[model samples]
Target: MKAVVYEGPNVLTYKDVADVSPKANEVKLKVRACGICGSDVHGYLGITGRRIPPVIMGHEFSGEIVELGEGVNNLKPGDRVAAYPLDFCGSCEMCAKGDVHLCLNKRAFGVLDVDGAFAEYICVPAKVCFKLKDSVSYKVGSIMEPLAVSYRAVSHAGNLTGKNVLVVGTGTIGLLALSCVKAQNPRRIFVSDLSDSRLEIAKKMGADTVINPSKENSLDVIMDNTNNKGVDAVIEAVGVSATVKQSIDSLAFGGTAVWIGISDKHIDLEMQKIVTRELNVKGTFLYGFEEFRTVVEMLNEGKLNIDPILSKEITLEELPETMAQMAAGAGDIIKVTVVNND
Candidate 1:
């Protein structure tokens, strides 16, 4: 099997590797499409410690089950599926409550402890795999993970019907968050980003207003649009001090702010203001099992528009160079997917 192996910081090697065999109660899948996430770029740059070297780094993927391990039930070979990357201990308290993402013993594919789908084939727990409808393309199936993350963040924001919402950053997650917020029939959606290309894409994707903070003031634009009152909800997709601050400052009184981005930097927060304004600030990591299943259903029903968010598609051989380019911020690309054409 050929895979894009992460050797070290800013290093990726495309070479043949040992084929993976499914364990008991697992399935071996021939990968069809795997999307490159922002976290992957960060891992390549050694910014995030999530992607350790000597591992295949991809979790947002879709593939066909070529083989099933002994004891695997309800699914068989030739099934088209997308998998939830997190594997948790079923006996844990969090898992018992169906909050698997919070399980104390959790191993995330392409991240913490598991090898992932950056190759021709990979094995995953049969329980994590969900069958995809014929109407959902493999390209779209690869995006279910991030879409699930966006859905979870929006769900944290509670009811958005006829409320103003602000999404910070126009990256793939932010764009997907925008789409999820729109589905709730929000009165207006404001998107902020430094990239004009991404902002344009957000506009095309139904953002009520797009603000390039580099040129214009995003806070002013948001305030003016909402008649001087801040937005009712904010989704912070950029995990930076500035963006985190912006998310907190852009919320209305008693409004909700959900932080989905991951960053090590700490920001100074006005605890007094938070208390006075009665703001609801929450941090969301990954999606739970229910959110993951809901995202797959939404994709199958064609309720989410993911076409504009896909920027490029490349082969496995092109993955190393593409990761380097993404780490260097070379292009205005939003999302890149690696397809196995073999």
Candidate 2:
């Protein structure tokens, strides 16, 4: 088996490695397609401490089951599947409350304490694998993880029917969030980003208005669009102090704001404004099992079109250079998937 092993900062080696086998409760999958997430680029650049070196870093993927473990009966070899990527203890309080993503003992693939799908073959817990419908391609299946993230973020805003919504950042997650928000039939959707290329894609993805903060004021656009009342909901996907502030500043009184991006920078907020406006601020992490399943179903049903969001597909051998480009801020590309052609 060949794997792209992360050696250190900005170093990825494509070399032969030992083939993986399934544990008693696990199943081995032959990799098909795996998408490079923003977190992967950050990890490759040693910016995020979540991904340690010597690990195969990829969690958004789809594969075919080649070997089933001893006790696995629900699925068999030759089944196409996508995995949830998070291994959580079902007995935890969070899990009991259906918040498995926040379980006390949760481990995610391609991140902490687990090897992931940046290889020809990888093994995952059988319980985490979901059978992919024949209609869904491996490339689309691999993107379900990110789609689920966007779904969870929009879900945090409650019902969006006939409400104005603004999405900060037109990155992969932000663009996907825009699509998900559109599905709820919002009155209008606005997307903000620094990249004009991404903003163009956001327009095609159903953003009623797109703003480039580098040139024009995003708050001014939001204000003018809403007649100075601000949007009813804002999705902050950039995970930066400035974007977070903008999200807060662009919300209407009694509106909701969903923060999906992860960042370490400290942000100052106007507590007085929050209290006076009675605004609802929520932080959304990864999706739960239900949201993940819903996204898979949505893909299967063709309710979510991912064609425009998929920017490029490359072979495993090109992973290193691709990661480098992404680390350097590949603004033109939205999503890059590594296809295992071997």
Candidate 3:
């Protein structure tokens, strides 16, 4: 097997590794396409606590089943499928409630205590494989995970129809959230980011307005667009400390702000605004497979057009250079996918 291995901080290499064998109730997939997620960049830069070196580095993936272990009966070889990526203990209280992401024993591929798909083949639990139509290319199936996160964020935040929503970042997740909320047909949407390129992408993704705080002013643009009233909802897609505060400021008197990004550390919040404005700020974790499957349907039905966000595709060997570009914020990179094995 040829895969991309994390060497150390800001380092990656393509190397030939031993093929993986499926455990009981698992299946082996021949990797066809995999998307580069922000967490992969975090782990590449050694900023995230969960990612350790000497491991494969991709999670948002789709492939064809090459083999199935004992006890696997629902699927067979040659099935086109997407990797659910989440590993949860079905016995936990959260799991019993159908919230596997919150289970105490949750494990995610390419992030925590597991290997991942960024190679010729990957082994995953048979339970995590969801079949995709032959018409849905592996490239498009790879997007199910990111859109699933957006779906979870909006679902947990109640309604968005006819509400003015402010998305406080224009990354892939932010852009996806913009599109997801647009399905509800919000009154207006304002997207903020430091990069004009990303802000442009957000606009095409259904944001009514774009904000580049570095070039102009986020508060001014958002306030002006909302008829001097703050937005009805603020979704924080940037995990940095400053953006968290900005997300708070974007809220209206009785708006909700959902934090969708994973931050590095604790950042202070304005209790006064939270109390006086009655603003709701909530944290949404990953999605259940059901929501994930919903996102896949949306993609296949053409309700969600993610084609504009895929900036480039690279081979596994190009991951070292291309991933560095993504980490440094260079190049007009959206979601970089590995299209071929090393």
lDDT of each: 0.89, 0.89, 0.84
lDDT of 3 by residue, 128-195 (tens): 88888877778888988998998888776678888998888777788888888888888998888888
Tell me the TM-score of each prediction against the true structure. Answer: 0.92, 0.92, 0.89
Residues forming the 10-long window of minimal summed lDDT in candidate 2: 261-270
Please give the lDDT score at residue 54 for candidate 1: 88
lDDT of 2 by residue, 27-85 (tens): 99999999998889888888768888789999999999999889999999999999998
lDDT of 2 at 56: 93
Which stretches of candidate 1 lie above 4 Å from their native place? none
Clashing pairs in 2: none
Candidate 1 residue lDDT tens string, 21-76: 99999999999999998888888888778877888999999999999999998898
lDDT score for candidate 2 against the true structure = 0.89
Q: Where is model 2 more than 4 Å wrong at Cα?
A: none
Show the lowest summed lDDT stretch of 10 residues, model 3: 333-342
How many residue-pair clashes does candidate 3 contain?
A: 0
| Model 3 regions lying over 4 Å from their true place | 47-49, 240-242, 262-268
